[model samples]
Target: MRVIAGTAKGRALKAVPGTNTRPTTDKVKEAIFSMIGPYFDGGLALDLFAGTGGLGIEALSRGIDRAIFIDMDRISVDIVKHNVTAANVAERAEIYRNEAGRALKALEKRGSAFSLIFLDPPYRMKEMDALMLDLAERGLVEDGAKVVVEHDADHVYPETAGAFEQLKYARYGDTAVTIYRYNPVRSEHPMEE
Candidate 1:
């Protein structure tokens, strides 16, 4: 796989060395960025289920200030490190080997709100609503942030859930990508000026 745009554009990325991790395809990656952003000004990103760190690295290359990558597999984590280094963006990346749930909880301690979140969990793990809710409840998602969910084309997520509202959806071959905008609930009563 390779970064499709930004400063790291055309930089080749290393795979996880097996079929265990499925990296996002270049075509889909390009399409995804086109939907959310072809580039960014500056923001923090979270790649939760980060396989080879392709998505997070791409975000960094696209001008995201920094990114945190989390994956449970050791091989995938190592490959992510290699890929980030190869892309010459190791300093802007924080790689961690931990399951998504634990990683989210631990991330709460950092108090970093993510403007971009990529959820590309294994296709077998169907339920993503809980994870979305957790990010909201923990305040890990910034207001108006974008959350991208990649899954099997056969499955479809809700149009709105908790603090996230679906903004875009597209299917590519067997993969389906859904983008959600996070809008935390605002108090109905306005504060007096």
Candidate 2:
């Protein structure tokens, strides 16, 4: 795959070795970016289930000041680092080989907050809602932050997850993309999809 746009536009990216990790296709990646931002004015991002670090790298390329990529698989971690180096964005990124739950806790301990979060866990895993809730409880999501979740199209998601409100949903063949915005001030009602 390749960087879809921005400073690293057209830079090649390597997928994590083996079939355990599925990289987001360039089309879906472009669509996700278009939904929240075609660009950014500098902010932090977290790729919670980072496979090849594509989402986080894309965010950094598109203007995010910093990005943290987390994955439990060792091979994926190495691939992510290699991709970051190839894109010349290593200085703006932090990559770790850790599972989602533990990574969230660590981030919380560090008092970290992200303006953007990407969740693209394996299709069989269905913890997006719980994960979002954890982020909310830990205060790890900045107000107005966007959380983009990529899942199988068959997966069902609620209108709201904790402090986040569903802002948009789209299906790309077998994959679905749900975008939620953290809005703690609004009424406790979900926006209609």
**How well does each candidate superpose onto the true structure, as a TM-score?**
0.95, 0.96
Per residue, candidate 1 scores C-alpha lDDT tens digits across 79-177 of 999999999999999999999989988999988799999999999888887799999898899988999999999999998887688999999999999
Tens digit per residue, CA lDDT, model 2, 43-121: 9999988999999999999999999999999989999999999999999999999988889889999999999999999
The positional error of residue 131 in candidate 1, measured at the CA in angstroms, is 0.3
Q: Kindly report which residue pairs in candidate 2 clash with one another.
A: none
Off by over 4 Å in 1: 186-193
> So what's the TM-score on candidate 2?
0.96
- Number of residue pairs clashing in candidate 1, backbone atoms closer than 3 angstroms, sequence gap of 3 or more or interchain: 0
lDDT, residue 90, model 2: 98
* Candidate 1 collision pairs: none
The lDDT for every candidate, in the order shown, is 0.91, 0.92
**Model 2 spans with C-alpha error above 4 angstroms:** 187-193
